[model samples]
Target: MKHLRFYFDVISPFAWLAFAKLPKVIEGHSVTVDYQPVLFAGLLSHWGQKGPAEIEPKRAWTFRHVYWQAHRDGVPLQTPAQHPFNPLALLRLAMACAPEGMTPGRHACEKIFRHVWEGGGDANDPARLQALTQALAPGRDPNSDAVKQALKASTDQAIARGVFGVPTVELDGRLFWGVDALDMVSASLRGDPWFDGPDWSRAAVAPPGVVRPPKGNP
Candidate 1:
């Protein structure tokens, strides 16, 4: 059986969509999935990049695109009461739900993701969070130092693995980013020869034709 690492942050609608579609995407394969919760803000800071919601036009487009994709795929989706809200609480809560020395699995992660994406509710509303905490009965304190460290370690590991975004599936040392890559993931898992071909390696080695100056320079 293949082991797949699914890295996600609840702040991403694409992460929620990917989580919803993952089961069916790997239906016929024998695979174990480890759901990892990482801070989206940490990733953004590490990579020196702006999030989809940080740019006005892209934020609008991202929402539209995700809603369309969800509707087309028959996945239930509702925009949260706010966009780009802090996800640290949710991330820590997910880590807390897992046993010590292990990351949260699908069941725990799913509940957290659904809490943010299912009802168009305020994800960070104190009452709603309290209700969720009660429901999960986490083994650790969500605000505990141990839980915070665990989340930080996970995010750091993801950074070392070249993960620059959420909803990334790490399979056999290759990082596939985005919900749209699910089909490719399935194909690769099924031993597609294309993965071993020149094109895959060639694309990575291709040199950039144009280089833009640093943000403040230009």
Candidate 2:
């Protein structure tokens, strides 16, 4: 059996796509998806990268690409009422709800994602968010110290591990970023030589410092 840790931020459209496809991907494969909540803004800050809403063409493309892909893949997706909204409450609520096992946690994550994105609702509205969290977690307090600490720990650990994006999975020291990487993840899990493609392995022969390096490291 393979156990994988899925780090996600509910505000991410791609993360919603991952949630839609995960169940089918792991069915009968003896795999378990551990739903983990990490702040997308936290990742953006640490990586020194701009999010879609903070950029021009990228912001436009993010919505277009997600909707197109979701349609093509038979997944439901809709733009949220607010873009780049604060997700602290949602993140803490997910961690707080997911104490027992994978199913309940995945369900909770899906509910939050669908409510905010697919349902075109405002997750930032405290009363609404609190109601949603209460339904999933029952008495769990997003403002409580325990939930805050857990959320912090998960976000800090995600940064420590190479998770600069949502819908990322970590297993056996291998980090797969983005929903597109799930295919490679499955191949690797099947004990196949997943990277047999020619020359792609050597695509990064030069160090980033010499190969169009970014301004700074996280």
87, model 2: CA deviation in Å?
A: 0.6
Tell me the tens digit of each residue's lDDT in model 2 across 73-172: 9998878788888888788777777553222267788888887777677778878876786678544566788778888788889899989998898876
Give the range of the ten consecutive residues with the poorest summed lDDT in model 2: 98-107
List where candidate 1 sits over 4 angstroms from the true fold: none
> What are the TM-scores, per candidate, against the unseen true structure?
0.97, 0.87
Best candidate, TM-score-wise? 1
Q: After superposition, how far is residue 33 of candidate 1 from its true place, in Å?
A: 0.8
Cα error, candidate 1, residue 147 (Å)? 0.4
Question: Quick one: how many clashes does candidate 1 have?
Answer: 0
Which pairs clash in model 1? none
RMSD of each: 1.0, 3.4
